[model samples]
Target: MNRRQFLCTTGAFAGWSGGVACQARAEAYTVDRALVLVDLNGGNDGLNTVIPIGDPLYRALRPTLAVPHDQVLPLDERTGLHPSLGPLLGAWRGQELAIVQGVGHDAGNRSHFRSRQIWDTASDTHEYRDDTWLAHASLPAASFVASCTDAARSIAQHEAAVVRIALHGFDTHENQALRHAALLGQLAQGLMMLRARLIASDDWHRTLVMTNSDFGRSARENAVGGTDHGAAAAHFLMGGNVRGGLWGAAPRLNALDTGDGLPVSLDFRQLHATACAHLGVAPPSSVERFAPLPLLRV
Candidate 1:
């Protein structure tokens, strides 16, 4: 109905419930599902990550940074994944990965602090809310934070109700080619390995692995072989129950906003709501107005 109420249902879906929601319902959903959040610490380059190989405009936009068309791991005739993320191909084939493209409030607010606040609260670009979504959800909003690169391994062992991981080194302000390649390789490997571990422990089916950054990098490469911060990013969702495949329209490179950034096709709240729906939480009327994304299996 209202912004805070929208976030209230959303926080539960985002895995910040902290058992507070469960206490009221008697601990039913506690052990069944857990959310694994992979926060690409800095803005990730979405254009390169989800390469638009068929779009001539993409190569024109980032000639130096574009992955050779021949090398792209083809998802469709028009779309492909960066070579560095080759490890994820198996999941793609198995239908365990869902790629949501053009996700963000808008191509505005390039400031990392501001963008993250907006995401954390599921606020639209035009609105800013002080309270966190978790507090509104009636959850204590607790966390079990570990900053190590190897924290994924540790996270598998503990299996908290929710785990938010920050993979550093995405802020590729200079020399983005080499830096982004290495980071993407690491990301792909980490995701594949995490899935393998979950499968071994019989937790893969219930664990949802989602990735997002503060925002997305510019659609065009800068003179320094890097990109400046922009708005809108493509995100990935992987899990046994995930309805794996591409979702939403690709970022419209030909049609750029005033910031020369891709316009937001699907609001970031839609992504949050998809995850919330996966956890069987009803969307508040506000998010429901955006409609449903069948991101999870029935």
Candidate 2:
């Protein structure tokens, strides 16, 4: 098509008057890009994982549980990460890790079964849905996986658009100090290896890795050096397309909920919306109302 012919055919594409080039960018999924969901099966203790090292309340609330100041991987003056997550520092430094803090629903439940249902379906506390949130978004269903390496391979090979990997044993009701550290260590190692493989295969930019859980553990340490079921946990989003750094406020340790849980600062649905849009797809009808976070590169 010559200039005049092209202008006549596509001039109105973006309300163009033919003085300059007009382009149309469709809002649809890029079939080649993959979304991987990592489920931290049991409730993760957000406080210990993403420590507020500068907060005096953190030490007071978890005298036996708080990660020591020096040992915490410093992210800022007020925030730090668990030493076990050191492997993720490269992603952090490379601006591939975006941390979403205090994420939960206002009507969040303490029961693991009920809360998991809410997250899985992306429904209101009083609502119920048999299908998953991704199904509502009209995306492909996730492929179940036992290994991050396997999931990374699939993404690299273009085997799946969506994959779910579950890591169990986050419920730390006893001996949490040791147990939680080990679990975080495993998570960091798996993600590091998975990221390395993706980077090697040239799939890192087209792949997004997100982590989730049933809920968060309580802010206050228990008598047995552990935490109970709580709310408002932290989550991570990693990919070359990500705009890394902290996205939400660190929970106020001084002002916990009645259940001794951190206050829900950012709605989890917002995350769903952001993820959907990040993939160049519109969010599901229910999730459309929530504002998408600016966590991804344009």
Best by lDDT: 2
What is the TM-score of candidate 2?
Answer: 0.86
* Native-to-model Cα distance after best TM-score fit, residue 276 in candidate 2, in Å: 0.9
Candidate 1 — what's its lDDT?
0.72
Cα-based lDDT at residue 288, candidate 2 = 77
Q: Return the lDDT, model 2, position 228.
A: 95
TM-score top scorer: 2
Off by over 4 Å in 2: 1-30, 135-146
Worst 10 residues of 1 by lDDT: 135-144
C-alpha TM-score for every candidate = 0.82, 0.86
lDDT of 1 by residue, 137-238 (tens): 112222212232233443344333445666777778789999999889878877887788778777788777778688888888889999888777789999
